[model samples]
Target: MSIAPKPNPALAELAVLEGEWVIELSNAKFLPGSNSRAQGRVSAEWLDNSALVMRQWQWRRQGDLDHRA
Candidate 1:
């Protein structure tokens, strides 16, 4: 008899966000004096040192992700 290996929950959660993600917030304020389209970019990658790092950047300028105004 053969038994299948159990899936790793941490890996599963990490899988969902393993790729680059672009998100936009419509008419939302992010900072104290920011009231415009909030765009964000998320990057997830595993380093060669066996460490997983997630980086994100948010902007409210043009040419960024549209917040659907």
Candidate 2:
């Protein structure tokens, strides 16, 4: 029989962000035009209960799609 290893406390601490979140950006110069607004959804979760990974998708007001790992 095989036994699973205990989870690391530091890694477990990331559980606080294990949910869907709404992100909004306003008055950002990163956009093509000035004074832009963007919104998206961020999903965070643990990978195999060991590491935390976040995936984000955003749509800019200028019809642009952005993703982050």
**Candidate whose lDDT is highest:** 2
The segments of candidate 2 whose C-alpha lies over 4 angstroms from its true place after superposition are 27-29, 55-58, 62-69
In model 1, pairs of residues that clash are none
Model 2 TM-score, 2 decimals: 0.62
TM-score of each predicted structure versus truth: 0.43, 0.62
Clashes of each: 0, 0
Question: Pairing residues by index, what is the TM-score of model 1?
Answer: 0.43
lDDT for each residue of candidate 2 in 1-69, tens digit (9 for 90 to 100): 976666778776678888888878787878665667787778877766677778555454557756554
lDDT of 2: 0.71
Candidate 1 residues lying further than 4 Å off, grouped into runs, are: 1-9, 26-35, 48-51, 61-69
**Residue 66's lDDT in candidate 1:** 31
Q: 1-69, model 1: which lDDT tens digit per residue?
A: 976565555565566666677876665464333455556676777654244567554445445443321
Candidate 1 displacement at residue 29 in angstroms: 5.8
Who wins the TM-score comparison?
2
